[model samples]
Target chain A: MTTRTPFDIPAHASSDDPRVTLDEALGTFEPIPPYPPRTEREAEFYTLRDGEMFVNMGPQHPSTHGVLRIVLKIDGENVVDLDPVLGYLHRGVEKLCENADYHQAICYTDPLEYISSLFCEWSPVIAFEKLLDVQVPRRAEYIRVLSGELNRIASHALFMGWFALDLGGLTPILWSFIERDEIVEMLAALTGQRMLFNYFRIGGVNGDLNHEFMSRLGTWMSKATHQIDSNNALLNENEIFVRRARGLGVIDTATALNMCMTGPNLRATGVPFDVRRAHPYSIYPELDFDIPSRTEGDCLARYLLRMDEIKQSLRIIDQCLHEMPDGPVMAKMPRLIRPRPGRAYAAVEGPRGQYSTYAISDGTDQPYRMRIHDPSFVHLQAVGLLTPGNLIADTMAIMASLDPVMGGVDK
Target chain B: MDRALRRRLEARFGEELTGPVRQRHDETEIRIAPGDLPEVMLALHDEPDLRFRLLSDLAGVDTGTTMQTVYHLWSDSSADWLRVIADGLSRDDPRVPSVTFLWKGAEWMEREAYDMFGITFEGNRDLRRIYMPPDYTSFPLRKDFFLPDDASRSPGGGVRPMEQTHGPTNAETAAHVRQASSS
Candidate 1:
């Protein structure tokens, strides 16, 4: 009997063995190398000081959000440096979009940020609409904002739960998930699916606000702010939650801007830059809401900022409901979609940050190139910058505060 | 479109620009040579009137003949998104300067562009592949890149499922599975 190793072939086996070439091929797919460091970053990360050691948080660790592996270089409990090893959940969505037609490409983008899939669909749809020079009806624009804000609220609810759960609290996740479930259910009625809703299309949204969705939103809105306040009351003053998150992973404004952070993370640093406000797309210019910000730039500040933004989102939703113009939801369009050969960049301020898509058309049905700029990808880089001096325990807390969904990060 | 901002850009980079500045919708685009990226980017970042501090996005494009790196910038100076297209890079070895000096955030975006299109950022210290595994050789987003199943990728292979550039063969996978179940 041959001693078995992972994808190993017996050393004494003849070269003519059928498995020889296959085994050699399998060897290259090894996730970790049995060999030494190959690149400069790998060498730097692998090398350790006398008392320091490397700890892998996960591609499987519960706190990583999704299949994200963070390599932490630690001396005692203090993280000396960290490297984020990504591509674990990479679906090659951009490459896939290049092969698919414009309308079909929106469906491909739906799962990039699974928590806020509507925003994922929104950017690409807007870009395609720009390429086609299609003017969507006013009612459709309002519905997009209405449904998008609902998704944002749901996402923030989940973020609150996950953030609290990461800091050794259990109750908040349940509360947040319950809130998130209600929103998801409401969204399912509006769209067809619970998650990864391919609701946004090139011309407009898939459907108008139906009775089921309207009823759910009306019920949820009456007590939404109160429920959020009650759930936040559980952690907003709790000593452990505050102590763990407060003043931990502090990033200042200049450093935050230099890191290209947007959304809540940048807002927590007092930038006041929301893509919806700064670069107005859709009917956001018609809506009135403040871009809530905090000066501290700590994990606590980030958490608190999202809680505040939930109110702002609710305000936007309320305004969207009251001011929704009566018209057709989708515009008249041809059967086949082929945008003119040009480039379009469209971004929306999602719950996470700026979810943008840059689409280049070559007068063909399929996009010549489609690049998705996810906020998670930009914010994940800042983790390496933020975690160097912090303790190991605070690593997850810091990451949770940033709220990086690995789907978006890896896409 | 902001014509003044377009005019200002033309006046500033008229000589260095490869093509005329084009403004459409809410975007103003400029085509520049690869050599002028760093100089132009520096001016856009530092100039008091045109302080485009925010690096909104960086994208890579393959025009079938030439490779291009597109950068989108947002600033209070201009209402429109300023796009700088570093055009006409050699397809054989597409190399452009990195913008990490101005926005440290451009590092990963540049790395991704390099990973997908093989466009090397000359000044990026950490120019490793971001998405593809370290052993991957071919740039996936290149116009010529073909899947293993595609006839053009491996001619006369009869669509061999496991004969991809990075994946193992069926026999090897089965062997691994058998070994795993026993363990």
Candidate 2:
């Protein structure tokens, strides 16, 4: 039994080194004061009518995704106002990245959007690469497109499952997980880890798609269409599902743009703006794909748009496989990757929305600033704005429709 | 295209331009004094030619010498991405006017700016901390306010978990969660 006390310092540990011991360093930082006493009442954000009351929804509810607490001020089943209290999942990721090396930070991004972590990791990788001006080979671009589209399918598939599950169904999620697990397994074959595959490197992807990966992808592509068709046949045609989803929580273009919602949620509002087409990052310009959008701007519209995206993603993957060029995946780089002191904003079309990263390097191996434009974080705010007038039960459907993963929201 | 933007912005907000309109390889941004932010942003939003309607992203950075708040704007019609840097905010008392009135997107972003950099947006109505607990005094994003035994140290890795130096998260919980699953 070898249990070591933290106080047992090594003999070689120097008293001279400030980092070695606590020694007055603990006093430097001000401690966070505890929240207020139970008796003291804070001013209500919403003035409730005489009979109205406030309902506290989960900080740990299944429906809110992950530890998302929403306080709804309701007046007879109709929500008068709602406030989203965030920060349950915050780990000071930005602060940690500021201290870690540019390349070392890629590992930290995996947990940020665990569902579609590849897309989450893509923004920072491309942003850091842009600042360094590293030239990714054409082959690497094709691989990225292939893997990214597959990952997108996996993400939206998971969404398809959960979106239905949240609306009181289990079978859709069962169908979703089957396809999702297969995709994850194939991804593991390509990238080593299942979820949060830190596969993207400073220059390019960590590795190339093997023959096994290619053949597996070929098999999965055909199967994916069947799965999509099955899911569409199962859910979209269901009158009950359609009634639950359609014409509920519609956001107009002006309001959607103002609130800064992105991806399918924004596209649902009739804006034909996809960052892939709009920004022209990677080899998306060369790839033949259409930006699928919906004019309805409701829960069903958003749902259908995501379904449409899966078909488009498959199209992109097919093109990448057919038009793939042969070359090295990684770009040549200096031993220590220290980009020059400058700023760059690079964006990728995340499964949910615009997963943008803003990188500022200060001539050090570490980045000065790495700010993420998390789509879920922005989308969560819509809960406050849009949820006010809707029915209390509809909040889940509306939130589910937005496709929020707390990894992105609370990062 | 950037040359024309430089000319147009230069002709409009001449003296307000803190540095030369820096049009980098990937990003295009015009640096302006913090006081000139409202005027420039309003002009950028309302202008027919330069219709930067969407406030895509806003972030604050502490660059050793000074703190800067950067805004990324996307114009729908023209398909142009623009970066606007509002620099020279006091590290001690960083403040900028809230753009919430202009664009509702700035509401949460401005709160985030306040939470991370202590950069108060003057006109923002709901300027409470978004990520961190309301009581947390120190701004986590600043270069100086570090977690205990940060990994940058050359000596060794941190033996103990982190203390409550940053935001709502403390190291005790982190340590407990990281322990072996079997036990």
Best by TM-score: 1
Give one digit per residue, the lDDT tens place, for model 1 in A205-225: 789899999999999999998
Residues A245-286, model 2: lDDT tens digits: 999988999999888888899999999878899878899998
Clashing pairs in 1: A58-A69
How far residue B28's Cα lies from its native spot in candidate 1, in Å, is 0.3
CAPRI docking class of candidate 2: acceptable
User: In model 1, which runs have C-alpha deviations exceeding 4 angstroms?
Assistant: A1-38, B148-183
Worst 10 residues of 1 chain A by lDDT: A23-32
Point out the worst 10-residue segment of candidate 1 chain B by lDDT: B174-183
The deviation in Å at residue A233 for candidate 2 is 1.1
iRMSD computed for candidate 2:
10.3
Cα lDDT tens digits for candidate 1, B77-175 = 888999999998876778899999988999999999988888889888788888878778767776655445344333454444432332211112111
**CAPRI accuracy category, model 1:** acceptable
- Give the count of colliding residue pairs in each prediction: 1, 0
Q: What would the DockQ be for model 2? A: 0.24
- How far residue B61's Cα lies from its native spot in candidate 2, in Å, is 1.2
Task: Report per-candidate DockQ.
Answer: 0.27, 0.24
What local lDDT score does residue A92 receive in model 1, on the 0 to 100 scale?
88
